[model samples]
Target chain A: MLERTKKSFLTALWILIITFPLMGLKTVFTGEQAEVGIRADAFYLAGVVFLCGMMWSMKGLIGRGIAFAVPPAKSCTGAIKTSVMKVPVWCWQVGILAMLCAFPFMGSEAELNKYFSFLIETLIYVSLALGLNIMVGMVGLLVLGYAAFFGIGAYTYAILSLNFHVPFWPSLFIGGAIAGVIGILLGIPSIRLRGDYLAIVTLGFGEIVRFVLKNEAAVTGGEQGLPNQHIPGAIAAPSLGFMVLDREIHYYYIAIVIMVLVVFVVHRLNNSRTGRAWIAIREDETAAMSMGINTFRMKILAFAISAFIAGFVGVFYAARMNFVNPEAFRFEYSVLILSMVILGGMGSVPGVILGAVILQVIPWLMRDMMPNLLREYFPSAANVAGTLTDFRLLIFGGIMVIMMIFRPQGIIGNARRKIELGVEEERD
Target chain B: MFQHIVDGTTQGAIYALIALGYTLVYGILGMINFAHGEVYMIGAYIGIISLAVFTATGMTLISLPLCVFVAFLAALFFCAAYGYTIEKTAYRPLRQAHILAPLISAIGMSTFLQNYVMLAHGKDKFDFPGIFRAAFINNTVQISGARVNYLEIFIIAASLVTMLCLHLMIRYTRIGKAMRATAQDKKMAGLVGININRVIPFTFIVGSALAAIAGVMVSMYVGATKFDDGYMAGMKAFTAAVLGGIGNITGTMLGGFILGLAESMGIWLISSDYKDAYSFILLLIVLIVRPRGLLGEQVSDRA
Candidate 1:
């Protein structure tokens, strides 16, 4: 108990140290303005509180204070196993704390808020990448229409929350449940198919969803989209003495919490029986079947679970953005998310997070930063050459090519996954 | 509805040409060559550049035939080089990897190519010079109140000639047979001393050339081309290829015509804004009922 308490204390201390600069800087920078400044100050305080809670919980791991509290292992394997199990939990606490602290800093500028939105968007992709990692990465299912689930989630939330005025949290769960059903329906066809055939079939299913959403204008709001819905408040009480609930900073934390939850759940699933079964099926479906695994059921489970997670994220996205359009849930989004999973280490959790963050945040950052720098440095050239948004696709495309050529395993790839996924073979 | 048929056929011919490239590449490499559409898009930009340069040189009405020929060659060379580079850089490394690697790389390359073009030429459409813009014969040969353009006849003839050439190339040539052999069994052909490397590049050259011709034809017909045209057009052509049979050349041609006809009729029946929805709906139904496509052979899992 003493050791655990000490460890928790250190984790709390580390979070405080890491997040202090951002909190301090925000208060200093935004001191002049009254309304926005006060709002920013409140956001920073909330961030500090959340960070403190996170750090307190993580102190044992960060400070090695729980070393004695850990049950003495008889073998090296046991010790290593325990350490491995503890590492991810520690990482999650650290990540959540970092995100909370970063939220206030992100809201310092209007432009930075867009990047923060993108960061939240990245969290959504991380959710997707984790979910897809189960299907394509673990189960070896080549799903070309993963966006169908995303659309289902988005449409479900939009219809329920917008039309019926249902609360965000309930609508979010319903959306996930609806998407889960759809995923199961789609997975039935997978029983008879494999590889490219399965891919094409999923592609068809995805297109069907897209077309239906496009044509069913009454239910979906069609091309015009469902818009202007206010973001749901976190607390029911109106007299909480804090009004950061509707702010972008508050939404950022909501996304961060959702992302952390998703990561935690997926991480647990990865180490569970289902994740192992998925790996078995991925390695060899025939072998998995020979081992008495119901391969069909597993594939369907993988699809359903992945879709469920995607739908969960989709709800948050709709609420945060307060908009849902068919165009937003295009085939390209599916492909892009898929690319994030593959380009990152396929089965590696941290790799998926890194991929999601880089792909989502980097482009937006570049979009915001590059054009202004170009304009400021070369005013005359900027007039004639145009901004980065005009040429953003080219630069983004170049980055992809470079990544594919140089590091197919992605920025934070796993070595074992690299070999298993055949990334090494491709490198050769 | 003669005009609809004419317009549909013209678009169908363009799709057919691009689909041939997709089919041929798929047949040889067993890969979708998703970047093929971008190659077609690039060809249109090349044609635009060629027109701009030629027009600036005081060439008033450079015969449509000569202009098209030049555009075709320029597009062919540029796109062929791109195809060769893509194969060498993106695909060559992932040759032994899971099929997903190459597919993802192709997507990356697709985005890269589109973005590259968008940057080089602004995001908006570039007008094709008026050399082939005018209708040859504006007479109404009405089937049911729709007027037909005689210029569409030229598009059909061009498409036929390109198809016939491709047919002959695959049927008669030694390299063509080598491509077929390589597609059938890469290792066996390599052991038999067929240079798979040479044959693959040659396939890309032929495929990209056809796509270039299609791009020029599309520009001539549409009167303008955009940097992002490849994505929509590519998706349509891919749909056409899949609708017929992915690796079957002749099936792709039939698929293109069917898709074009279906799209035109569907648009006429419904709203034009939902034309994409119509094609995708048809594609979905076809995939669900006939996953192997109308003429595609069953693909065996090798990896």
Candidate 2:
């Protein structure tokens, strides 16, 4: 124990020295003067580093104890597959739907906006993740700039609504259609390239889309984006025939409905012949072509369909937020969405939703929601509550690296994909 | 046109410097080192921060050249260390994993590095000490017919020397031969007694060291550096690597120049507002026409 403690101290000291220039000294600009301030958080960092080193040293001892609590993915997936079901799958799905429908009522009347908005946003992401899953999971196309389509769908609706006074209902279909058309156009020349090359092309395309949106000041309002913040009530809330969706609860119903429709469409497509052809192309394009699969055509179809689904959420998100900005459509946002798809195990519907929820909620909880809740409920532990807020993204990055290192197949990844990703070679 | 050529060549040199790193890593691993751009960005930070620290400690007062030299050395050393550590921690374990694993992990690492700098350095752009600019600020040289600033000329000359040194090192050195052997066939190279582990980390170290040169130079030239600047520059360098043929060293250098020239000429012809679009358009056209880039490629079909 003493030896481990000594080693931990050495590791922490090393970390401090290595990171001294960057983390220890901080540059703070006040007015016109620049000053370097020593960050007091160095001690905290050293403590954390020491703990990690000790944890590393005692891995064998801890592993046995932790193994029983958290099962390996192989066994976890097997448990899901072989476990006895008390009720039918459809009944459970219906139960979930009913629960979702009753979400607004579950929350207090005053907090309807707060609670429903959260659910609404979650549902929107669920839809987006499912849409991205079409191309990434089923079709096997890696799109680095899927957010461009989302931005397009959003900007299309926002522009049409604010300028032409077009209703949200009609703009939904129009935006999705426009996005799908753009997808087909994008996929035409680029789809012929191999997977890795295609990744860069898509990345470039995404950058081009963002740059164009930023550059075209007149159309996109440049960096500030559409719907000027200074001018309130310029853009109205989305409306049904009865009334405008002026509250979060109203938007919640629409989001859940749209999400279900997306899930159904995606589920149907995944089991369809077209989906199989796309998978064939992904697995081995040459073989797929030899089998007369019309690989290029199938690839294009996947792009269009996936882009279409992402487009729907883009419209809903813009309408719900009553704002559209180029900032929302950055490469980082695309990375976040791609993380969702990859985290969920690419082609699995439930996996994608679970991945979306975990990535979304965990970060959200760390950044503001959970911390605030903790401060409100437990005043004594306030110091430790939001301490993780600043490092949420750093923690997130570390998690991604660790997750990929240990389980590249992802949590509840597709069985075949799990094997393909080499997660099963450990033979748990 | 003459002035634009000088500007293009200077800018292209920087891109080429960064692109060499990308192509070299891709040659070895057949995976895109997504955090490479971050390494370059971090290089710039290290350079500037070191200068600030030196200036604060009265080292610059003692000897300005010595301080600058020390600063450059610090930047190169730290960046190379970062590259080696990143590869060891995030990537080395996933050597046999699927392509997506390493790619996503690199992206995550890139994000972490960017945010780490952002948190430490603050999100605001910081000014470089203008060590190089002092010599080239007002000095202009007649190149062909155009009056080119010494800084631009210096950038071009520095880039050429760096590339030449890299070429010589790779061509003549034992480590270079080992690297080439590993790139061609890892199994064979291992059979022939080359340590794959040593070669991979060495490749990252060398690439990162080259990126440090570009980072310091660009920070010196631009006068300011931001945390997120790497993403775009990195993308363009990756584009350059692909345009030249991804794994080919000579081709990447040529690709960087072509892209730089194309962007400069495009900006001169069109509006500067659409500066970023020119590279993408050029990339699209080249990809449509050549498929394998200008010099062709030697990417292994394994992972």
The best candidate in terms of TM-score: 2
Evaluate chain B of model 2: give its TM-score: 0.95
- Model 1, residue A382: displacement in angstroms? 7.2
DockQ of all models, two decimals each: 0.16, 0.46
Query: What is the DockQ of the complex in model 2?
Result: 0.46
lDDT by residue (A1-428, candidate 2, tens digit) is 88998999987886676577677776543332345667766667888999999999899788877786786956887778776355676886799999999877776868666666667878888898889888888877888889999999999998888898888888889999999999999999998777667887888898899999998888988888888664654555677778777676778888988999998998788778987787777677778889999987898998998898878778888887787888999888888888888876778888889888888887877877877888999988787776678778887888888888887766767755555656444310
User: Which one is best on DockQ?
Assistant: 2
Pairs that collide in candidate 1 are: A7-A59, A7-A60, A8-A59, A8-A60, A11-A59, A12-A55, B1-B144
Interface RMSD of 1: 14.9
TM-score of each: 0.80, 0.92
For model 1, residues B1-303, the per-residue Cα lDDT tens digits are 666776778788888889888888777777778799998987777665565544544453656557556766776666676667667767777666656667878888898877766654557787776644554544335556776666577778989998998888888999878988887778889999999889888888788888888887788778788978998888788888888988888889988988888888887777786777666677767766777777887765433
| CAPRI quality of model 2 | acceptable
TM-score of chain B of 1: 0.92
Off by over 4 Å in 1: A1-115, A228-244, A370-389, A411-428, B1-6, B60-64, B135-146
Global lDDT of each candidate: 0.73, 0.84
**lDDT at residue B146 of model 1 (Cα atoms):** 70
